[model samples]
Target: MIREITEQAWSACALRLAVDEAALRAVAEVESSGSGFLPPPSQQPKVRFEGHVFHRLTGGRFDTTAPRLSYARWDRSKYAGSSLGEWQRLEAAVALDRDAALKSASWGAFQLMGFNHAMCGFPDVERFVQAHMAGGDAQLAAFASFVDRAVFLDPLRRHDWASFARAYNGPGYAANQYDRKLAHSYARHHVPGSGTKGTIV
Candidate 1:
């Protein structure tokens, strides 16, 4: 999947975020294994896990305080909702009809949510999904916005490859999975999201 998209579409949007072909290829594989319908790992707080049970039990700060209330009845009730993994959600979302697709959720190639998608500059859910589905450069640009903000700006911009990868994929994610992936593609690749040190894009 990554090969198909990057070989065709990576260049189109990669320039916008100054990401490397190698890095984009690595990220695409890490993110979805190149499958457009796979879900992202669940990064939402546990409060969202229990859903309404969490809301009623904890008075709405469930994400932050749920661990403390593990003994509550509501905690047991938290199982009411289905725990959808990242891949399941992605498959369901992409297979939906147009109206259902737009309203379902905003996760795309990288599992970016509604506000994140909009903030990253996609006009709407359709645009976000379409971009990922289009593959190649279009998907590259959409996913790049996520990389730029989360990984590039904060730590990567400072020439901290390890830190940048950690920030992008959660702590240790970059080191364990992402870095090695890129190494196979380009030997001289610099860490992305940092200041100008090499030819960008």
Candidate 2:
């Protein structure tokens, strides 16, 4: 079954993070197009396997044997191009090294990387994956925790999309115009001077 997050969960997350609902929604929209999981039949939480991360976590152990699953650098061309394909890549990597595989993928709507499990309030990557697999509510909760731990609330509150994108997506965020996308998404969801705490509408 595909478990989705309700509007209430979004509002609650925004409230917990002390940011406008639109701001949080903007991040979610950009991260996973506003859905935490892939389409049903699988109902699995969306994931993007990062071969570079796997390579780093495994010390390039599988680079020669599994070049597609473990590379020294980020290679967008290696992606399977669909959620299903991505899952296959992940499974293949998991067979090689379960911990490294789990830690290499970005999970759920917010796309919190598995390596960030501790920062996102999970004790380990496995626990983080379990929570993401649970439902969108858990994903949102993890996002809130990540934002809190990362000190991103100030940027969100100030509508500082550039800073938020840079911090969240790293220095390469400019390549994908993540800041601009975030600003546009926020504009679409935010109501000016509404004095609303957590209402997207």
Candidate 3:
């Protein structure tokens, strides 16, 4: 149904997380350019398949048959570089192992990994994918849950982009300049003198 997150949803998440709205917005922007779904007519949540994750989940079984969908290590060169292409790769892996394939991809605006479903308050990878497919509000809710469980609220509240990026994006965040991009996005979204304190919703 293409249920995108509304401004009210963002504000509610900010209040619940006790962080500035801009912080959440910045992460959303840097992670998925502030949208959860792919271009219209698809109604599919944005996704990025991680072949390394697929490899881990399947014990290298598909590594030989589906090298592009399952690799032992992260390889940017293998990426299709488009939402449609990524979905195609994900579907190919799904044909091999449905569970592992679903869990091997990052989903939605926050780009939360399916393996993190538990941390994000979902019972399983399928539930996680369902939530993401429900749209951005669900995606943001999952992101908030993850932030709380991962203890990223403090860093986000303090505008500690480096720490947030390192923890949220993993140790390889620096290679992608995620922290810098987050900081820049935050600056663009932050209102002067609004402070980083949580506002009453």
Query: Could you give candidate 1's per-residue lDDT for residues 1-201 as a string of tens digits?
Result: 331344335555445555545455544444444344423453321111223322343344433543322223433343334335423433433343333323334343454443345655687656665565554445556666666674465443343546656666557565366655544433343445542222223
What is the TM-score of candidate 1? Answer: 0.47
Model 1 lDDT on a 0 to 1 scale: 0.44
Ranking by lDDT: 2, 3, 1
lDDT digits (tens) for residues 100-132 of candidate 3:
999999999999999999999998899999999
Off by over 4 Å in 1: 1-3, 6-8, 35-109, 149-160, 172-201
* Candidate 2 lDDT trough over 10 residues, lowest sum: 192-201
My TM-score estimates for the predictions, one after another, are 0.47, 0.94, 0.94
lDDT at 92 for candidate 1?
A: 35
The global C-alpha lDDT for each of the candidates, from Candidate 1 onward, is 0.44, 0.88, 0.87
Output the lDDT of residue 134, model 1.
Answer: 53
lDDT computed for candidate 2: 0.88
Displacement of residue 154 (Cα, Å) in model 3 is 1.2
Candidate 3 stretches with Cα past 4 Å from truth are 195-201
